[model samples]
Target: MEGTEKPVSALGIEKDLNDWLSVTKSRNGTWWHSAFHNVSAMVGAGILGLPYALSELGWGPGVTLMVLSWVVTLYTMWQMIEMHEMVPGKRLDRYHELGQAAFGEKLGLWIVVPLQMMVQAATDIAFMITGGKCLKKFHDTVCPNCKDIKTTYFIMVYASVQFVLSHLPSFNSIIAVSIAASVMSLSYSAIAWMTCIHKGVIPDVDYSPRSTTTAGMVFSFFSAVGDVSFAFAGHNVILEIQASIPSTPGKPSKKPMWKGAFFSYIVVFLCYFPVAIFGYWAFGNKVEDNVLLSLEKPRWLVAAANMFVVIHVVGSYQVFAIPFFDMVESFLVKKIHFRPTKSLRFITRNLYVAFTMFIGMTFPFFGAIIGFFGGFFFAPTSFFLPCIIWLVVYKPRRFSLSWFTNWFCIIFGVILMTLGPVGGLRQIIVQAKQYKFYS
Candidate 1:
């Protein structure tokens, strides 16, 4: 009877469209794919802000926060990988799917989807601004005598690339892009810190707080934590990355996924630590929010670094955007019951890219946006959500190490999520007073 029944209902149709448009449809990714994808996902525009974050927090607190974030986020990332295939034969292909497994269906969607969407969207917006800014930097350095161009035009050029690439379907389709982005991330990160070391420490550098008032110091500390939190933000894309790998009953995707994630974290450490420490050492409290902006003397090297940043952000943009495209297409096809066609995807994705570009052009507060969104949504998704999901699903023993660890992360993340915005908002307001939109 069941075999005789038609799989032609509205629900069945929705499922089919979702599968067709889903970013995880191509399950051919390998461990190396995971490695580079993770790298591209984690090491983007945020790493450039580490020195500025250190400047705000000073030596002790800055180092402590960076170290703590690395350890905690890695542990949480491992938890996500392990839990990916925990349900005997089922794979939690999306972050929201895992959330649904931990919490009941509607509640899970409510909690995870909004946070995950915000994190992905915010990162894309940040990348747009970063790519545009770096492009402007490259232009300025190479042709100092050339007439100046507004940053808005550069940002539009950056978004135009995405409009073309966004047509690439599935996570695996963009492997080449992600790989190139990953390499560029490592390359530019090296250039940033190495250039700083070459420049040497500034004369009579001040290591004290940037702000004199106690309130200002405290707020900057909060914003600095947000900056550090922003640096380790690959967790949002982990499940989607894992979904692109093949899995079977004998050899689940988690094994290769974990291997890739482990090695990626090593790369993450290599990229993040040196940039924060050495850049801070070189510039002290006077370092620009974007370290690339601070290094001016060696024109050619700085120009190359800026170009590398442009390429890296261009590649990294898709790593975050694919999931977003999936979300948009799924909504249009499933909820609206629209037919899945190439035309539908082209229009939707192009519009999304244009929207982000417009926003980036409007409010290009690179550092403030990083700190605000990093704490506002990135904190929950990257820092503590995995731990919370672990406890909810696994019910780790009371007073056990797992229990204590999860709780500690939850507490720390909540504090970051709460206070990070306060500082970031104040900074944005201060910057806004001096900024002219689309100028």
Candidate 2:
């Protein structure tokens, strides 16, 4: 396949591929910038969705899960730093290329293609669903005929908004939006915490005396790890940022990007840990999909939190959409030789938005979507991908030991991924059996 291509069209494809490939070789970004970009990417839907995950494991297991996730994320970040240093100019697209270089094309594609699609699809669903929920909240609060507004409507509207927002002309504008959304989310979360803490409405689930079986312990560990994986799954984004960094005209300093990643992990863990712990402590077993629900806040505060969550979810969708859209664009241009004209870019962007919104509208249950994606698709993408990439790229001296760790991480990721989906599926199926439709 590599040696026998003679078609002129194939030459065009190769040229396009080479053009995209050039981005990987331009090493010009800083660690702090990479960290901020990554944080913006990962901190969205995960923060809103993690509390419910914690509820499943109870307090001790939950706290353990948070810490374990942080540790695993830190380790993964270190590995990512190593990969960046080893292959200084490669992006996620280049990871598969690296895999091909290290192993073979078939093996590389087998791993990268499916994992990439799964992660993006699941993330898109999460963004759409959460966005719909936020819009619903707004609708219920502001509209007189709020009950008439269907979940599908909100999903469609939000999806359209995402498509438009993401397709804006400038990168600076998008960054500005991300910054604004982050600020709003942080402010609202602070207010929600204050409201909840002041009212003393946080629930207390006593899991101190519960028997911790071996299997239970394992589940807790993976679940926590899974949470961390979700929280820190922006290594791809980091690489993208790294690739965007401008190299010196004549010479660039060889600063380790992992130093930035290490500190970024610390900053993320510090931000997430307190929120997860306190949010869980406040709500206990009764924590709802949005942890803010547990807080007995003023109407205005609740409204503010809902708006913040909506903005956060929307911002996340935009961030996720960029890569997904980029991949789509790359495939079309490189594989199909389709030029990315302004009109073509607009159409493609809108198409993704419409498709994602349609899915969200069809499946209005945010919790179910989060559970399914987090457990099934996200688990492997988060935990297994890095390990597999390490094993394949590095081959690590001891093939057997590396293989064992690779499989171990994969198995652990798979289990964590399954629990949420299986449990969520059970709940959905049972509910369907009992009732004709979603209430």
Candidate 3:
């Protein structure tokens, strides 16, 4: 392939390849980079659906579950960061590396890589649809008289940006985009809740669950759990973000990474809570899946909020897409023995973006897809997989507080993983029955 570089020896070949790849070559990131990257990765289109999730769960269980998810995911995220440099002189830079350290090499790769990739891919597809829907929303809000454009075209427009941003090469390279995404996430989230409050509760608004049948309500509740689980899904990429930070014996990466993550969590709290609570409070049980869609009165403000969403997801698509790029590139160079070159990277990245864009256009059921992906993949990776790995690697005393805590998380996470997909799948089927293809 063009621009391929050959190394002098076998050892040189491995090192040379790592250097050529985008992620491994970067080690200049700071704590603030971690702050915004975490914010960008963690706060995404998922937050927009939270009010709808709340509508399914109702006030008490809804609020309680959201708070618990915040606490548990925060604790688990801290564990992932700490484990990043747990091997003293060596850094477990990627999630799979940490998994290999805990489980045997093959088992670790089998367990972690599939789950992580699914989460990343699912998130990217969800963000694609989200970005497209928001673009259409923005257009409709601002120029209602214009001829209606097909959503598939709008999704293609969103993916066009990703086609460019995907080639940025490294996590560090996208720092500026991540920072802007973080700001936009906070801004649009505030706009979502504030507008809801401004509108006040809908006249004679009903707080009742949407489903009338008992089975339907149960499934709706389970699907909502999936949605909430999906909202905290930045765990899959935390180690990757830490991988970009420079680490040494005297100054480990964990300290700065955790500091940055703590601030990001505060941003997560700010962006998630009021939006979930007040959005539901104002709209009651009738809020749209993306809360911005529910408020259309202040045409200019709603349009601006939708534009913020379009920009925010533009950054978010790249944040989630980086790992997918790394994994595929690594596989091509190592397992398949393809030369590391610009041509290979260009082909791999463009194809991946196209795949996600196609999926989003075909089945852009945002709420249902979030619920399904959240429960099926995210619940395991974000909710409890870290605790399981910690127990295997560290073996904290059987009945100690740490062990009990991990056990609790594992049990809770397993419940979510099992039930969330059932509800989400059912909803997808229902939506699909009435939908036209790529309309």
Best model per lDDT: 3
Poorly placed runs, candidate 3 (over 4 Å) = 1-10
Model 3's TM-score against the true structure: 0.97
Clashes of each: 0, 8, 0
- How much is the lDDT of residue 171 in candidate 2? 29
Candidate 1 vs 2: which has more TM-score? 1
- lDDT-wise, the better of 1 and 3 is 3
lDDT tens digits by residue: candidate 3, 45-131: 899899999999999999999999999999999999989877766777778888899998899999999999999998999999999
lDDT by residue (313-397, candidate 1, tens digit) is: 9888899988888877887876797788988988988888998998899988754767888889899998899999999989999
What overall lDDT goes with each candidate model? 0.89, 0.60, 0.90
The collision pairs in model 2 are 24-89, 28-245, 28-246, 29-245, 65-224, 202-282, 203-282, 375-417
Better of 2 and 3 by TM-score: 3
| lDDT per residue (tens digit) for residues 79-152 in model 2 | 55456545554333344454554557798767665666667666777778777777777666555354576667
Residue runs of model 1 more than 4 Å from their true location after superposition: 1-15
200, model 3: CA deviation in Å? 0.6
- Considering summed lDDT, which 10 consecutive residues are worst modelled in model 1? 14-23
